[model samples]
Target: MNNLSKTTLIDQLTVEVYQNRNILGQEAAKAVVLKMKELLSNKNRIRMIFAAAPSQNEFLETLTKAEGIDWSRVTAFHMDEYIGLPASASQRFGRFLKERLFDTVKPGVVHFIDSENSIEEECKRYADLLSEQPIDMVCLGIGENGHIAFNDPPVADFQDPSIIKSVELDLVCRQQQVNDGCFTDLKSVPTQALTLTIPTLVAANYLFCIVPGTNKSEALKHTLSGPITTDCPASILRQHGHCTLYADDDSFELVANG
Candidate 1:
């Protein structure tokens, strides 16, 4: 087996694949906070999109503890949410942000997709809102299947125009949620989700993606070494001007042992 390690890509895009998952998560969170501070020093306001998943637990915890960030001037948004789920549901991204980042920092604004509302109407409304702003940064994670947000391989579109859309969940993605303990079984997970499109996520000035654990190894390889295609939605990050990836030992196997 190959040992995992970190690699520095061109520009400021560094990929750190650590042996310790907790260390990897903390480092990623710290890097994001530092980047946010640097951007805020120049920009009047900052907008951010966050991904909610068990993989992000450690990173989010570290971020919520980061000081020196003016949360009041920052507007927050989430990557995606399960359609038809109530905001109060434990599985809801809205509730996750409220408990994890929002209540702690109280950002200037929080734009959460109303998954409980009609999916089509909510998608159009959210797309309009995102279209009006240039997001400063986005924190995301890759699914075990290499999906970004809810843009599963089958539904992902690199040329998508709208910022938000409803997508059917892929089998691998659903299984991932179960494996991560987000749901008791496959049937408990939603069949569809409201996800931010590829163009919208890439529109951000910076993208900080965190991928940890052994389960993510294959997906990480595809994201880092594969062609930029919807087959691996995260591969699109390669085209962004300022995109960085953080991975732990298991997830970094390909890059590290190369």
Candidate 2:
């Protein structure tokens, strides 16, 4: 349990298991940097969407320290945002990314979901931006309830007609925010959010899903071994040819044991 313990394929998804969260984060960051370097070599710029959570801390920290990626050639976006959180709130997804990633790398362009605006207008605005060009990559995570972004089980749609939409956060999803310490309590978490749809996320050329911690073990197991259904939104990754799910001993245990 001191290094990468396993690498296997499930459907079109690649699953990598490491000894612990630190190793998992380092390995995932290395792979992401390598892919970024390769893509930047061929293209002038790349657009990427990222997830904001305590779970992403190690990976984002390591990624910011990596070399060879031209930050000036990158445009950054976030996968979701609370519909009512003040823009200045530390719990805001955009603010989290700003402090942890964007502020450090300073990507050429950073697009934040304008939660302060009308939900309808904000969704349309973000969707239009996402539609302007193909998303090169997406760095995300799985929720305790098997959600991707804010696409909780209750509302996930693999074939969502819209690029981005407003959604009511399910109980499990909101509790996860408290569990992650992003909020002091479930009631403090916003009940609704704006999220890029499943289709939009899976449309990215490359998907790097970093999920760690024992709290996520059950969800990770369901994602890798359970049926591909909206009930487990993360399970949809199995159908994406270029998606990779990274997990540590704690999170991968249930899947490994099965």
Candidate 3:
């Protein structure tokens, strides 16, 4: 928790503000590592879900470099992946996670969402994989539209029965893909995606939310002060028993000013 300058406990959520994004990621990764160690010491294996995006770059990179943890006892799953995107597409979410962290670690298993397969069967298969074990933790970020994964405002369900479901991408979410340089333009972005539902994500025993960059200021503000509604999907984090939000100055200042 080095250089964590401020903290606010809103409801069940603990929000930590860092001096910068690098520090934010480092501290979040450190906290997650500590939690993982504790879980592994008591449990035979731990399950983890991760979000793939430029916002998670620093946290995932720092986590991959952390030492002394037996990654072989960990099983990895990603939060979402686009439908119909070719495997070769650099923008594919699964490909992004593989290049950034999954390939770097020796997790006992890495379950990827098969978006190319039948959406119904893919959803069932992924849900079965998730239901195999309780998720110990998740490292995620908020989208510019305040989305948690692809559960955009229009599609997010707080009590979704299915663990994994498909959704049509929101305009703001698609625009963010372009802004993050995952695609050259909005037209290149996939309209539909398979996302772990809001209930599935919040079900984790612990949640490490790393949201950075000035582009996230507005979303951060909404999540921090706005009503806890699907209008700001990430706002639901406030109700989690063990969730912490790590944000940098660029994004935190928006809430600070208000």
Q: Model 2: how far is 85 from its true place, Å?
A: 1.1
Residue pairs with backbone overlap in model 3: none
Candidate 1 lDDT tens digits, 1-258 = 133355667333557666677887788888899998998999888889999998888899898899999988898999999986666689998788788878988898898889888877898888877777788899999998889889999998889977898889999999998999889999999998999988888889899998998899899888888777788888888777788888887788765565
Model 2, clash count?
Answer: 0
Q: Candidates' TM-scores?
A: 0.93, 0.98, 0.98
Better of 1 and 3 by lDDT: 3
Kindly provide the TM-score of model 1 when superposed on the true structure, using C-alpha atoms: 0.93
**What lDDT tens digits, residue by residue, belong to model 2 across residues 40-130?**
9999999999999999999999999998789999999999999887777989999999999999999999999998998888888899999
Candidate 3 residue lDDT tens string, 1-258: 469879999889999999999998888888999999999999889999999999888899899999988999999999999998988888888889999998888789899988999999999999999998889999999999999989999999899988999999999999999999888999999999999999999999999999988999999999999999999999999999999999999998889999
Consecutive 10-residue window with the lowest summed lDDT within model 2: 1-10
Give model 3's TM-score versus the native structure: 0.98
Q: Give me the displacement of residue 32 in model 3, in angstroms.
A: 0.8
Provide the clashing-pair count of each candidate structure: 1, 0, 0
> Which runs of model 1 end up more than 4 angstroms from their true locations?
1-4, 10-13
Model 1 lDDT, residue 150, Cα: 92
Question: In lDDT terms, how accurate is model 1?
Answer: 0.85
